[model samples]
Target: MRRIVGADAVCALIAGALGYLVRFGPAGTDGQHVSLGVALALPLVWVAAMLVARSYEERFLWVGADEFRRVFFASALLLATVGTVSWAFKLDVARGFVVLALPLATLLTLGQRYAQRQWLHRRRRHGLFRQTTLLVGHRAGVESLHQQLEREAYHGYRVVGCALPGGRDVAAQFDGLPVLGDLDEVVDIVRGFEVDTVAVLPSPELDGPALRRLGWDLEDTRAELLLAPAVTEVAGPRVRIRPVAGLPLLHMERPELTGVRRLTKGAFDRTSAALGILFLAPVLLGIALAVKVTSHGPVFFRQERVGRDGRTFSMLKFRSMVVGADRMVDDLAEESDGNGVLFKKKDDPRVTRVGKVLRRYSLDELPQLINVVRGDMSLVGPRPPLQGEVERYGYDMHRRFLVKPGLTGLWQVSGRSDLSWDDSVRIDVRYVENWSLTFDFMILWKTAGAVLRGSGAY
Candidate 1:
């Protein structure tokens, strides 16, 4: 499926580019052809959209809504550009032909994407084309890499464990695999692990010469060497690598927060929130009425939560449980799923009848957009831990305070109420450590689907 999408995309470009050339060639060469400018628009749009949507993340593709969405957006953008340019130049382009091509190209592109995904899925299941990685770095870094490989098994990278600095006393099982070796022993480790690739997760303090030497050493091994830059969760578009004389430097562009980006985000928040309220207003009203009528409590549950920069704000949600639910935390502590610090009950008696539906779909969180507009919270960010949760947090966990608590964050998207205290803290710390506008956008995008699926919601 991946190959088909890539091929179809390339074919679309060749076809579109060739079509343009044929149409515009000399005088009367090709009769009644679409204008060259219009013909070129199709492929250009596909390339641009593919780049933006990151369709090339993997080579062997499959059927995912993301694939189709990218194709549709690309097609739409291309046609829209064509229409605009035609109007501007007063070109005699047929609206019917342009309209007809949009859906045709989109369907073909989607079909190819689907076909490629199926092919890749089958190939992976048969172990025909699998990625074998030689992880190279410090013990901690290697251990982290090993765990990641184990977690995302479907991504198809099978780690034979890591190649550390020395063949020394690497624990018998680091993340349930023997440490193959260290940096000096990488070449030997690569062969022993039967790895086709090397991922360098070097110690943070690795000097330039050693770093360059690792790359040099991998040259003769006929294996791919990938530098797993300490940067994680930062989007690809925001990162740029530059090579100086015999030295490769990684330059990560700071996420833009001013001018058009700021404006776009602000506009997105306001417009989306406004429309959301419009569409969900009846539901919101109904929830509010239910809370008031059924429970002896306020319609909205307002709790003082830590926001951006550790500032305090009253976060709003539809009242799901009793008004004094906060007071029951101490008593309910023993009912938690995991750690004692964070309290949760699988089946709480305090929840109102309508609250279940509201909580399940995250409908209760709709009110937080008002907080977003008012600058008390962001649409996506770290979860706002309660003061008790914060007090219980280790030093490593306080990193979440660097940014405002989000309505939907890594914690919410990853597991929501099902997450343990440590897991919750880790997600927040990771978000704070690697927050970007693009990361936030991706989180927001995933959150929409996660909410609809209602996974782990309570």
Candidate 2:
């Protein structure tokens, strides 16, 4: 916390100095003196604003978007306070300095926070700086929470033990962790184990009053209580806590399937795709030439893919197979290395020499930019599925058609061909349910690293 405060203060000071240099130049005068005074005071005020916004709170630190949101709030609050004070006091505050410094400081602070988060995540992955967590819930809920925490170890939750509803009588150990006690013994177990966090999963035994009491009991301990509601895979933006008649209710907003945000996403997709196409024209041409010369097939391979609303569109990709590769699907089906639904082979005989290189780095998907431009696809969304794959989809999987398929999506960045069918479905459905511009941007950013590594690309 102190480190974050210090970093933010330094960022504010640097921004102020830069703003002063840019706005007032190197001149030494009364104006310079006043600017220096303001610059000296800015960092202190900025840090205080961040404190008021609770940006440095441990709960908001090293995880989620809430920390960044608080930082932004602090920036806005600081700006408002400065403007109001300057206006009320008739102070000669430099407009350019305020404008430049505050925005720059916000950016710098956000950047520093992101860097710190990455560092923390790296440490957590190596089993450092993790919180000792104690689970309190039913057997099934405890097991599920434990598994999830194990999978996302970078979240810094080390599940030490669990306290089920029925305690040791139910089982000696749950999910390979020692069963501490029952739900009623959570606080005692936390204290005994020196737990850093107590995660309470939903259970019939823990009602409103009981949960409130548990919270009150944990107040004296160093452990923080975290409530893991039954709801899963929903993004924070979609869920809100609404207090009505003294009851806190979880309100989930309907996914934005058809609205102004969707329209904006479409616009962004088209604009970004068009710019991408223009920028990568040379690379596209080079790939086209390579495919044309190395393989006796069209430069582009057009395949029917299921898009939004189960609509079929001809998805484009640079040819990465022999001319009659599709005809040999049945013959090669037995040797498949894919996740049942998707047919992928690491060493398929149909792939040409140049095709191998194209598929490795995902250069083959470059032509999908045209699909994005034509509104048949998005830059980020559920992966476009083959018609056969769509036909085999379960009813819940159909929800992925709520938005257009993407050139790259959760599935792409996650593992691409290496992901199991169930994993792929889960990831796609998760994205479909939690669609947002920010989510898309995050997926797109991850896509770049995924492509570079080509970890799952066959």
Candidate 3:
């Protein structure tokens, strides 16, 4: 936290100096430039604004979009404050200065934060800077919690021991982690192992009184208490803890994916797609020509895909396969190594040399911009499913259809063709349940890296 704050202060100073230099170079011969005073004051004000906005809070740091969002809003608020102050004092504040400085500062701060997070993640991946967590619960719940924490190391939770309550004498290992002690001696185990956190999963043994007593016991130790609820894939924004009659009840708001928000999303998709087409017209034409010259099939591939509310739409893509590739499905069924529902072969023989390059970098999905403009798809959402795949969807999977299919989505950037059916469904459903413009922005931001890396792109 201290490092991040120091970096942010330095970035603010740099941004202010850069903005001043870019606008006015240096003070005039008569000392008429604004940079001298503004540059000196901007960094201090920027740091104050960030501290006041709680941008450096632990919960908002080094993960997800919350930190970025906070920084952006804080910067905007600072700009607003500057504008008001200038207006009220009738001072000459350069619009160019604010324009350049605010964005530059935000970008620099976010870059520094990302670099710091990468360094932290590298260490955490090797089991450094991570909290040594002691798991406490029934066997099944403890195991489930351990699996989740093990899968997501970025959370900085390293399970060092487990304490099962009222269980028989067990082996040394409990779900791969050591069984330190039973619930009766959780405090001793925590102190003995010098664990950082005692993560208590939902269990009958850890009642209100027991939890209160456990917290009291930990007052003298460095161990913090964390309760792991059973909720899965619910984002923090949706869940609120409300204490009703001394019982903490989890209140979740229903996701609003309709009305004005939906209309705004549609407008954004069409506008962005239209502008993208206008800008990328030449590249699109060049790709079309390349596909035409390289393959015997048509340049554009149009196929039926399930859209919002079970509507079928003609999804478009650049043809990356032969004319009768649909018919080739039967022959490739024996070699099918997809996630069961979707048919994807990372090294299918059907791909031509040019098609392979196009798919590798996801250039083939460019034509789906037309789908976005035509209202058949969004710029971001769940991946459009084929009719066959839709038929295989269970009740929970149908939730994806509440919004329009997207040209790019969580499934696309997460693992693409490499993701399992369950994983794909999990990501898509999470997006559907937690749809927001900011979430869309984050996905779009991540899509750039995913495309460049091409890890899971076929």
Candidate 4:
């Protein structure tokens, strides 16, 4: 919710500035028909579209490309809506002005957002612009919470230390963060450190009355209290808070993969895949030729992978390893640095020279676009697990097969093979839980940057 408010403000400012530029390039600035009326109308259109499209809603800010997609979709709707109204009302609307305004507005808004994220990240690295946090939880919970906060510098939180309830040992330091004091000193901890946020990580023996009282005490102070659940990789949208009889009940919505949603997703996948194949046809051909000429094997690698509902599909890719690479699995396992379930090597002897280039820029995954068109895959989804990995699945791991696997996903944009199998499953499950078209686009956008950087590809 906070992210949406921040983003909406940024979008409004950028859109308004662009509208000005469109209305009066220079002469209007010289006080000739400034068109303040048109400028005002433009923001109204954008804001209305934003609201209608739910672009400024809370569900999308932290994840993949949903925010940007909503911006795009809303901007288009704004232009179309106002354009229609102008014709009906016989208002003097300039097509040239709107054409110039919309794209510029979107570009500037997204650019500024990226800049702000960079600035915020830098501030967090130095422990500046950080909210002073009083960690309230058990030792292990506090340690995990602290590390997570540290890893995501963009979150902009400074852990002053922890105040655990009924905590043992009452250590002076925990994972380099000081254990300020015990539970009874919660109020003092808040005051002494000037803490602005109290993050309560879940504890098995957490006192319900004490927690309630802690909230009461915090109401007097200007501190924001946050309860960090044991849930990992679960997105905000899946959780809903309802006040029933004064008890704040938290409900987690189950994953849905049927009816209109399934159809909508299928349409999205096919259309995107078709367009992608058309767009990258030339590049695909060139890469295929290069691989065929450079290597003494098949141009493509057709491997059976687990897909939606544990269905088996031959996922396609430009062959990166030697012919019969499957036979040497045990040999390579000896050299694997990948998470236990998956097989990966940063530098493998089997990779041909052309394969190296293909893998770096992610050209190897081009064939998956065909799979997308065939309804065997999606443009954005959880990374497809190999058949063997699927066979080894535990109860939680089964969630990864709830949706069709994708060419790019949270797992890809995140550290890729660098991430542990446990972490990969968690991210994949999160995506499944909060699946959306906008999210797919976000992951697709980030995939381009990831491919460009070639970070953790192997």
- Top candidate, metric lDDT: 2
Q: What's the ranking of the predictions by TM-score, best on top?
A: 2, 3, 4, 1
Q: Give the TM-score (vs. native) of candidate 1.
A: 0.74
* Cα lDDT listed for each candidate: 0.70, 0.90, 0.87, 0.78
Can you tell me which runs of candidate 2 are displaced by over 4 Å?
329-335
What's model 3's overall lDDT? Answer: 0.87
Best model per TM-score:
2
What TM-score does prediction 3 earn? Answer: 0.88
Give the per-residue lDDT of model 2 (tens digit) for 112-223. Answer: 9999999999999899999999988887888877877886798999999999877898888878999989888988998898999999988888988999999999999999
Model 4 lDDT tens row, 1-458: 45544555556656665666656664455432434466655555656677787766644543345776787888788778768977898776566666777777677656755665567667778878778888887877888888778767567778888887654355668788888888777777888888989888777555678788888988988788888867766676677898989988887776666778778989978987899889989998998888888879888899898898889999999998889878888988988988988888888888888888888888899899999999999888888988888788788878778789988898888889888776787788878877877667678888888889988886
Return the TM-score for each candidate structure.
Answer: 0.74, 0.93, 0.88, 0.80
Clashes by residue pair, model 3: none
Cα lDDT tens digits for candidate 3, 303-378: 9999999999898889988888888998898777798888888789888888888898899999999999999999
| Superposed Cα deviation of residue 458, candidate 4 (Å) | 2.0
Q: What TM-score, to 2 decimals, does candidate 4 have?
A: 0.80
Candidate 1: where are CA atoms >4 Å away? 1-130, 203-222, 231-233, 243-246, 255-260, 338-341, 393-399, 420-422, 430-438
lDDT of 3 at 345: 82
